[model samples]
Target: MTALGLVHPGHGAEDDYPRIEQLLGSDIRVDLVHTDLGEEPRRAEALRAAGLAERLTAGVEELRLAGAEAVVWASAGGSFSHGWEGAQQQVRDLARAAGMPASSTSFGFVHAVREVGARRVAVGTAYPPRVAELFADFLRAGGVEVVAVRDGGDPPADGVAGWGEERVLALARDADRPEAEAVLLPDTALHTVSCLPELEKELGKPVLTAAQVTVWEALRLVDRRVHAPRLGTLFTREPVVQV
Candidate 1:
């Protein structure tokens, strides 16, 4: 079995891992461990805290014991809020702590974009304008062009975890453009595993969602790939062996 560990921030949408593990078939195991977010709002200071090396490492031993071959910091908001270089250091610290290959959702989006052969992408995020821009800048630092960035507005009355298919599709539609080679949805807090097929169909292009890319990124760290056609284009492609 290929076990991938995810260090998530606080609560919301962690269940996407199990759903993806099932979709990836019987051989893949997704072990998730959440770090405390305390009373912090979903802004820069709080997000920076969320990706702190110490907080992320607290769950490393648990995941390592669970047979995790690789670990990923699974919160895009937290990682991107650290900026590109800081996020890189965060994962470096995590790798040392977990004693394995490590990455995060911010790098997941960047690497997933390249895996799909897309150089230009449009971002569709549940974060407000400011937070969404951080993601765009993060993408830029990875050499991917941000053709556009669309905010999904305030969280729903029930929050991002409660965002259904229609709301998710709308965000993709609002963000997609003719110039974009792919559309990126970068909030792991939003549940997107179920609607990946629909999002790609509606956009008629590749759609990379946070939950999906987080798993893909973790697997990529260990040079693993699973055939999950229902998950969308990233999964359907052959694995790119890392050098």
Candidate 2:
């Protein structure tokens, strides 16, 4: 069995695995470890800037205890908050603590974009403009050009969690840029797995979200091959091997 670890911000959007499992047709196990984002009206800056290494390590340790082979920090704003280098170090440290390879949703976007051979890309997020820009910078640091970005302002965390598929698809469609080869929706709080296939068809390009990329990266880390037609380019594309 392939066990993947997830550290979610809250109860929001934690159900992404079942959809992926449904698409991949069983045989994959998901182990989710949740952490509270504290209270509502939370500031992305504060969460990003806080010293979360201990908390993250604790969460990964729990996953390791549960037999997780790989761990993914499932929050975009949390990792993007520390900037690119900071986010990289956060994952590195978590892996050291857990004695397993680790990654985050923010980095997963970069990997998924590269996996699909996308250069110029558009970003859609349910965060404030400031938070969204941080994500753009994170992608830029990884050598992916951000051609466009759309923000959903500061909706209540729960409200974002409950965002309907129509609204998510509309935001993704609006954020799609002519110059972009793919559109990236970078929030695990948003339910995106269900909309990826239709969104890809509507936009005529690859559409990837946090939850989907998170699963893809975790599977790659464990050296497992997973292909699902409905998950779009990230799934359909072959994994590249680096010597």
Candidate 3:
């Protein structure tokens, strides 16, 4: 089995890992190691702190013991809030600490977009407008055009993690544009695994979610790909090899 480790921030949609593992079949394993988000509101600075190399390093041994072949920093907000250069360094530090290939949801989205042959994309996120812009900027740095950025305004009473299918679909539609080749949902806290097919169908385009890309990114670091069409266009396509 190819085990992929995920360093998740706080408590939210971390459960998506197991759900995705089940979908990818018994040949793959997803091991989740939760880290602290620190005692700050979900803002750029706060997310930056939550994604510090130390926080990620704290979870390395657990994943190593779980036989993880690769690791991903599973929070989009946590990584994107650091901007492009900083997020790149963040993953580099993580890879050094884990002694394996490492990536983050921010890079995952960027790679997944290219892997699916998409250039222009839109951002559909539950993050505040400020945080959403960071994600757009990060994408731009990765050479993907950000056609639009639509914030989902505020989270539900139970927070983003409690968001259901209807909210997720609305967020995608709000960010989608006629020229955009895909829609990116960047909040890891939002639950999206169960509605990936519905999302792509509703948008009539590729819908890349945090949980989905995180898993795909982890798999990519290890140079492995699995057949899981129900996950969305990203999964339906083979991993793009960097020549």
| Candidate 3 residue-wise lDDT at 21 | 88
- lDDT per residue for candidate 3 within 36-147, as digits (tens), equals 8886446778888998888889989999988999999998888988989999899999999998899999999999999988889988877777777888888999999998
How many residue pairs collide in each prediction? 0, 0, 0
Comparing 1 with 2 on lDDT, the higher-scoring candidate is 1
lDDT of candidates 1 onward, in order = 0.88, 0.82, 0.88
Model 2 per-residue lDDT tens digits across residues 105-200: 888888888888888999987778877888899899999999999987775545777888898988898899899999998877788888788989
Model 3 scores a C-alpha lDDT of: 0.88
TM-score of each: 0.95, 0.93, 0.95
lDDT of 2 at 19: 82
Candidate 2 error regions (>4 Å): 40-42, 49-51, 156-158, 240-243
The local lDDT score (0 to 100) that residue 230 gets in candidate 2 is 87
What would the per-residue lDDT of candidate 1 be over residues 1-243, giving only the tens digit for each residue?
A: 899999988888888889998899998899889898755445667777877778899999999999999999988988999998899899899999999999999999999998888888999887877788888999999999999998856544566888888988988999999999999988787888999999999999999998999999998888887889999999998654544
lDDT of 1: 0.88
